[model samples]
Target: AQSVSQHNHHVILSEAASLELGCNYSYGGTVNLFWYVQYPGQHLQLLLKYFSGDPLVKGIKGFEAEFIKSKFSFNLRKPSVQWSDTAEYFCAGLDYGGSQGNLIFGKGTKLSVKP
Candidate 1:
């Protein structure tokens, strides 16, 4: 009973441009991946995470992510983007066993940076 899907709800850029956001998850076993960002009022900030070896992971401002275990997918990249990176991009998932991490979000992707 795990679910997390975000195929871009609203994303409009201009400042610098270049940002990809598309995360999908249905879980098969152990999973822990997240990419949260909220800058308009600031609070949630962890632009990358994939609790495992390393299927490509990087966090912070210049975000990056790639954990494609059989296409469960975890995609969030930014080659070039500014205007404070605008914000509101959440794609989280945590289902290890007993389920206590308490994070299964993905109904947000509002990034509008027109400067």
Candidate 2:
């Protein structure tokens, strides 16, 4: 079965600090990468995703992700972070291009951005 691994379980940062969360997947065939964020008491929202075309994909809130197929990594990055960005970030992989409806999620990385 496919799986996603987040290197950091928790991250703490100050406002305006740069952020980078590592995400690696274990899928051999075609796969879709996604970054989801869940704020406190809020449902999961799509931050960014990469299925095809350009490897660099940008998302809302000045967030972006780069898909590196050779490295099996789709790391999320933001030049500057804010306190409001504090939330649980998840990395997910859709196997076989989402054909079988199998989505493997990571344990998630809790980001605490201090004001």
Candidate 3:
């Protein structure tokens, strides 16, 4: 079965700190990757996506991720994170050629930022 798993359940950091959240998926076929972020009291929004092309993809808010097919990983990264970055991050995917385009998401990674 296809699924996603986020290694970090929660993370705490101060302002201007580097951030890296692990993400892994168990799918053997073509997949469309995505990272969605939900800020405190805000709706979920797209952070990044990898459909077809280069493995490294950049998204809004100075965030980026690298898709390694061999490892079945798409790790999110940020050089310097801000207090505003405090939010829950989710890694998701859709099997392009599978039955449906429904998204498969990980439980989530909660991030806390202190000023």
Candidate 4:
């Protein structure tokens, strides 16, 4: 089965530090990629997504992700991060070849932004 993998399980950085969380998906056919963030006590929120059109898509709160089909990667990036950005980020992929709701997700990357 296709899956998603995040390069880092935990990441730490000071406020204002640049952030990049590596994410790769292993789906043979057309796929949709997404980044979801969950704060300490909040529900999981959509950070960014890539379905079609532009390879690079920007999402809420200065977050963006590039869909590099050549590498099967949809890495998330932010020029600078704030303490409030600290959260658990998940990389997910929806496979078009499978049944509906066939979404695979990575283990998740915990981002800790220090002030």
Prediction RMSDs, each to the true structure: 10.9, 1.5, 1.3, 1.1
In model 4, the clashing pairs are none
28-101 per-residue lDDT for model 4 (tens digits) = 76779999999999998999888899999999999999999999999999999999999999999986663676
- 70: Cα error in model 2, Å: 1.5
User: Pairing residues by index, what is the TM-score of model 3?
Assistant: 0.95
Per-residue lDDT tens digits for candidate 3, residues 11-71, read 9999999999999999877778999999988999999999999999999999999999999
Worst 10 residues of 4 by lDDT: 95-104
Give the range where candidate 3 is weakest over 10 consecutive residues by summed lDDT. Answer: 93-102
CA lDDT of each candidate? Answer: 0.87, 0.93, 0.94, 0.92
Off by over 4 Å in 3: 96-99
In terms of lDDT, the poorest run of 10 residues in model 2 is 94-103
**Native-vs-model 1 lDDT?**
0.87
> Any idea how many clashes model 4 has?
0
Quick one: RMSD of model 1?
Answer: 10.9
| Residue 54 lDDT, candidate 3, scale 0-100 | 96
> Quick one: how many clashes does candidate 1 have?
0
TM-score of each: 0.33, 0.95, 0.95, 0.95
Predicted structure with the largest lDDT when compared to the true one: 3
Give per-residue CA lDDT, model 1, range 51-77, as digits (tens). 899899989777899999999999898
Using TM-score as the yardstick, the better of models 1 and 2 is 2
